[model samples]
Target: MTSIEPITLTGKFVTLEPLSQEHHHGLVDAARDGDLWKLWYTSVPTPEGMAAEIDRRLGLQSQGTMVPFATRSNTTGKLIGMTTYMNIDAETPRLEIGSTWNAASAHGTGTNPDSKLLLLRHAFETLGCPAVEFRTHWMNQQSREAIARLGAKQDGVLRNHSRSKDGALRDTVVFSILEHEWPAVRNGLEFRLAKYSA
Candidate 1:
């Protein structure tokens, strides 16, 4: 069963489009906006390594383990970042919305919440998923706050869950919104996005 398919998810501020090699240059420029790769906790690719990273993500998508998206800003008409539906468990029909990074310029622009709202709506309303998970490095306080703002509860921390891009052992902070909780979460996200328009 192909639980996750590449699909375009449009929102007021951003659209999550299926990933492609053609997005490489745009992604690289996004990375350079804040030297995102230099951050120790994130897995963002360097400008020179963008193509290889895109290929790797596509390879995983082919293997049915991930569905990656290119985050595009509707206002700018440019690729601004990337996000993915990863750690897919087809049997449970659940997945994690992760591996996400955005250009520094895109921060505080409602792009993140808009993306989450779109992803969560499709996951729960259309895909019939019971739970949608989010995982971030424990050190990434900004990310943790963002996930929390989306109404996800902390599921707990996984000690030494994985390695960061800098090879540092990472404590993964897991969060989730259950099927029962999605309604409130969706409302909260929508309220947040609505502010961008006002």
Candidate 2:
């Protein structure tokens, strides 16, 4: 039973609220932090287009294929970033965590790990998904390393996976955590969050 409520998922350091237009202003400010997303070619809507983008995401929600969220810092109760469970495949018990962008201030903090922890727990523990996927542009070394640090193994890159916003072919590097691997991944994420919070 999938529920349509705006479920709130909280971790020790961050909270995830279902995406809403109300998050627009905070997200607009958050986008000014740095060019952390400059190299990303496939990320959608962008800072300038976020308002309409949020509406587009909500449209996808009605199709049951994507669930987006506004990431908030628990300490300050400020919206600091966004993440999503996209490319959802309920029958295959899989989802992809992408379209994630964080403000400059929260990038290296405990926010990311805590956010992922909450989502991972929900997807694997509560929802009983067999696997959860994380994909990023092939050139995004920072993201690839971050995913690896979360204990997700590299699943190879799909060359020419899609066209980028800039009209270039994109290669997507995929990573995943299977149900059997959740224990180690979860523990590693928790440890990382603890270290960051400390």
Best by lDDT: 1
Error of 2 at 88 (Å): 1.0
Q: TM-score of each candidate?
A: 0.97, 0.93
Candidate 2 clashes between residue pairs 3 or more apart in a chain or in different chains: none
Task: List candidate 2 stretches off by more than 4 Å.
Answer: 1-6, 35-37, 40-45
- C-alpha lDDT of residue 103 in model 2: 85
In candidate 2, what are the lDDT values of residues 83-182, reduced to their tens digit? 8888888776688888898888887888888988999999888878899999988987888888998999998999999888788898999999999999
Where is the poorest 10-residue window by lDDT in model 2?
35-44
| Shift in Å, residue 16, candidate 1 | 0.9
lDDT of each: 0.91, 0.83
lDDT of candidate 2 at residue 13, scale 0 to 100: 84
Query: Would you list the clashing residue pairs of candidate 1?
Result: none
